[model samples]
Target: MKVTLERNHLLKSLGHVHRVVERRNTYPILANVLMSATGDGLDLRATDLDIEVTETVPAMTATPGTTTVPAHTLYEIVRKLSDGADVVLETDGNDQMLISSGRSRFHLACLNPDGFPDLKSGAFTHTFAIKVQTLKDLIERTQFAISNEETRYYLNGIFVHTVDGPDGVVMRAVATDGHRLARVEAEAPQGSAGMPGIIIPRKTVAEVLKLLDGVEDEVKVELSDTKIRFTLGGVILLSKLIEGSFPDYERVTPKNNDKALVVDRDSLARAVDRVSTIASERGGKAVKLALTPGQLELSVTNPDHGTANEELAVEFDLEGFEIGFNARYLLEIIAQIRTENATFMFNDAGSPTLVREDGETKALFVLMPMRV
Candidate 1:
């Protein structure tokens, strides 16, 4: 395609889609981004079979056409160009795309646009609009708990659905990796009622987070049984939904954990970090939390490393008990808490522990204890 675009604008658009291009692809066209130039602007599309991202940038069309070029290579070239420089992209007859900016020039091998796979978007059965910050909050609160194990494919994404929350209906996002679970809910937005539950894959969630990083505008979401689409500003992301049933997460959440301990979130997180420093480096080392009337002690021991112990004043009325937990898990959950105190509810030393912000019911974290 023959078009001239500002260097920064072209680079930003390329950054959005190039991430979806697979580094090693069986099909040559899959490694390239489809660039189409029209009188209005330039359209850039990239995909990795399961997910597709498209971005549009205003450009001056010299000779309107379409071509496919290496996504990463083109991005790197544009990124290195001087700021504010006008970038010119045109196809040469010898199956190559020429990129020029000021004194810099590069020729990249091009593929036929026809060879690029079409990103199939199914008709959406449900469509909703949500505030960018609300969606981002749901992801940040639970995404850390998504499983990385390939065998349990269903656990590799956040389970999103409508739930009867404490305050009327709300949209809930839950994720668990068997060791720890995170559940966060937000007030349901307009047109979200009766939407079917969907599992958004980890990769797609990452991409969506990137798109909404600094954006505060509302994002339009369209979904079907097998596909999901997100439109924000001038960008469009379409992803295939994971076709598996998520576990019944409600059953895993402890219902009657009575023992309560309230500790400053920062203090607890710092204590865990300090104690875990001397913990075993192999498996996520376990930290022992000893809770008494109004004091909590965190301790860790490793054969190779030394031992660490820290005491923090907390608000606990339960009888003294000790529980073992993965230090890393505690830190991750603590990072999600935005309030001053992190409340912990425990049934026993061997049972799962429930954690949440003090006096907050919209977000909760459950962590399975580890044997010390």
Candidate 2:
């Protein structure tokens, strides 16, 4: 196989798909990217058994053929080459791929393209198009809550589905890690009302986010019972659905928490950061929040580090109450709030707390209190 492509174009295409290649692979071919050169352009494909990404870039095809080369190694070589330089790729009889730039050349071992796993494209039961910004918002607001634990595999990704909102049907994304939960809603795209709820794995969510970054055009999404595909620009991403049921998240969202405390998001985040400095070094030290009529005081105590406290004025008129929370968890949720004010609804010191932006009901957070 032989092809010539602009340095920037080759680098961009490789960058998009190389991330899907797993660093540690038991199979040799799984670590390489399959490259197919045609008269039109070049096709690059990479996969990690579960998720696969393919991208096509315009190139000058010298000879229409196919070969496989190490994804990361080739990407790094192309990245270091002088910008705007034309890169030539060809495979020799010795089963090695030759890479050449203006004044540099390298040969990498090539594997037979026949060993590369074929990604089966199945019929999609549902298909729709969504605005890039809307989908990006849903992911950015909730992805941080996805669980990293492997035992509870169901909680390892964001739950995406359609739900009834105040105005009408809307697309919602929810994620929880047992300690904190985040839910964000956006208007459902046309013809997506009957889409089946799917659990998008954590790694797939990350890849999708990266693909959506800075993309203003609409993204096409197709889904089936066992697989999902996203197509945007010149790239197509196919991922296997997580074969597990997510928990009933609505049951855990408190509906009877009456006490309300409205405070500036930045102010509360800063206070939490200051007080947690003296907190336990192990678990992000628990910080105690004492709420009164118009004042909120945050304090932390650690036998080995010392103690710290900070006070901030807030809009609370309920009876005084104190609650304990992990400092790191609190900051993570607060960082998602874009509005100036954040509202917290609490039932008691031991019960889970509900948080939201002051006047927005489209997004909500539930955080379980910690014992100080």
> Backbone clashes in each candidate structure, one number apiece?
0, 0
Worst 10 residues of 1 by lDDT: 277-286
lDDT of 1 by residue, 6-74 (tens): 999999999999998889999989999999999999999999999999988999998988989999999
Residue 243 displacement (Å), model 2: 1.0
The lowest-lDDT stretch of 10 consecutive residues in candidate 2 is 276-285
lDDT of 2 by residue, 114-160 (tens): 89997787898999999998989899999999999999999999999
Model 2 TM-score, all chains together: 0.98
Model 2, C-alpha of 261: deviation from truth (Å): 0.3
- Model 1, residue 133: distance off in Å is 0.7
For candidate 1, what is the lDDT? 0.92
TM-score of each: 0.98, 0.98
